[model samples]
Target chain A: MTVSIVVVSHSENIADGAAELAAQMAPDVLVLTAGGTADGRIGTSLEKVLAALDHAAGGDGTVILTDLGSAVMTAESALEFAEDPAGVLLADAPLVEGLVAASVAAQGGADVQAVKRAAEAVRGPSQNSGPPPQREVSEGSVTGQGPDFTGDFELINQAGMHARPAAKIAGGLSALDAEVTVNGVDGASMTALMTLAAGKGSVLHVEARGVDAERAVNYVGGLVQAGFGEP
Target chain B: MVLDVNWAVKWLTLCAQAMAEHRVELIELDRAIGDSDHGENMDRGFQAVLDKLAEAPPATPGAALKLAAMTLMSKVGGAAGPLYGTAFLRAAGTMGDAAEIDPAGWAAAVSAARDGIVARGKAEPGDKTMVDAWAPAADAAKAAADTGGPEVLSVLVAAAEAAEAGAVATDPLVARKGRASYLGERSAGHRDPGAASSALILRAAVGAAA
Candidate 1:
């Protein structure tokens, strides 16, 4: 069973919309929304949060992403009062981005803690920042203790390294047992990849290590070569 | 008079009345630095507490407070919901299965409630939040209980008076937490809506005892 996600927001649309977007990226992950009050107002409801937790109880685990001040408080209160709070984790991350990252991680069979880490790691850098720290080994096979596989591929898609392509690459890489970095950012992080801001024809240097290292390299190569199923 | 389940219910009812009466003033206070929904949210939450009380009559003071806690958390629909809900829930936890609360027990309950607010809101006394009122009220209750005299009315009165003074004390300080904190220095000069409501609630407790 994969880890599940719960989105808590003051506005029903925000919670549901974020959940929907995350679900689209991670079809296998269970994304639940506990938004708005019982009377359908723009406020969180403890009953809704409790009910969502109950529904997600039997899963591997549940990670909650909340929006705004009171939503965090409400989610914490629900956890405090929950019958079995052991498997539930509340992530202190932005609602939409955190939910999507958590969902992708959950979809890739990450454990509850890893899923939370994925969500929280989204906050490492805001939308515009320098490239994230990457474990850059070298360009080629070093004295043999190096990446299992490495490759260089040019972006063929007109849009280049955008959100959808980044999600596809990150989602696929996360499922592998390999650690991969492209252009000096965590390859398993969608937002991190988007921050690369690589335009069309920009060459991407990929390095990977682990059992699925070859597959990870080939995965990025194939996706980039195919233009990420785009025109 | 021993504080029992009936007194608990009446205290909650009086809290509702007070919230309804001061709704506009709270709205104005919040309008100055907050989102301006504290009054409406509290009134609606306590109204839900009243409905829940009617639906399921609690057997003891703790049960009543627990019921109110759950209801307020569910119905308030704002930060106040969780804040007040936690306060009531912690107080209920301290009361345990006791059917009647002695003066010392009442003092302990108020202190627990204050702790709950601090833990939930992460606000200190000078933060211009409900903790301002709750902290002094809890201290006053404890002091009154420690005096070792007839304490039923004195404990409630002491708490109410301290809470009122604490609420007033928030007027000149810049908000250090909550939505008002976003206003920075501009948040000064306005009484905190949460502190004001807290004083009103403690005052209602006195009315119930009287």
Candidate 2:
């Protein structure tokens, strides 16, 4: 079963709208909302959050994304009182962006931990200054340290490296056990990929290292070569 | 006097009365630095607690506190909901299923409640938040209980007085946490609504004990 997502926000409209937007990118993923108090006021409710956690318990796992301060506290309180807290995780990421990234990863069949990583990876350059350090290959390598797999592919679609294509590449790669980078930004991050702004005919430099490194490179190559199945 | 379920019920009822009595004053205090909903939220939350207590009369002091915790977290539509909810819940955890709480036990519960608020809110004593009141109140309760006396009323009175003084001490400090922090220098010269409400809650405990 796919991992479910819960959105916690002080404003009911914000939670509902964020879930709605994430649902568009990952239609198969279940995104629930627990926002506002029971009396329809503008604040989080532990009961509402606990109810959402209970509803999401049937899935493989649940990831919680919250907005503002008290929302996070309410989510934490719900987890403390949850029947199965082990299956629920809280992502310390922005609500909208993190929710979308998490939904996309869940749609790609990522497990609970991977889905959380997908959401947290959305942190902008300000939070994460640079690309992750390249992993050193243990096996006999001519170079002292290098990526296990590397590839370069040109963007062919008219839209180039847009939201959908980036989401596809990032979403698919997040499920893989690999550290990947396209150009200079994190490949598993949708927001990072979008920042590249690589237009049609621009080449994407890919580097990967891990058990699924080769598979990650090929996955990106396949998506780019086929124009992400878009015009 | 034994701190039991009856005392807990009386404490919460007095808390509701206090909130209602000082609602407008709390709103004014919050308006100076915060979102101005502290009074309304606390009033609504305690009223809900009162209703829950009526519907299901708790068997023990801990049970009553647990009921109040859940109700506050559900009905209070603000940061205070989670903050006070966590405090009460943690305090209840310390009480366990015991029918009566000794002076030392009550003091430990107060300390646990304060710790919970600090952990949940991540605020320090001088942050101009509820911790300002709770921290000193907890300390006073522990000190009073440490005297090895069976006088529970003395411990409650000490905690309540310390909380009241701590809340007043927040008047001139610049807020370092919560919505008031956004105001920067403008937040000074104003009492923190959270601290005020915290004092009121502690004072109600003393009133119940009396």
DockQ of each: 0.83, 0.81
Residue pairs with clashing backbones, model 1: none
- What is the model-wide C-alpha lDDT for candidate 1? 0.90
Model 2 spans > 4 angstroms off: A125-144
Candidate 1 on B94-115: residue-level lDDT in tens? 9999998988988999999999
Clashing pairs in 2: none
- TM-score of chain A in every predicted structure: 0.83, 0.90
lDDT of 1 at A90: 95
| Candidate 2, number of clashes | 0
Stretches of candidate 1 off by over 4 Å are A125-149, A209-214
Per-residue error (Å), model 1, residue A221:
3.2
Highest TM-score: give the candidate number.
2
User: Residue B113 error for model 1, in Å?
Assistant: 1.0
Q: In each prediction, how many residue pairs overlap at the backbone (N, C-alpha, C within less than 3 A)? A: 0, 0
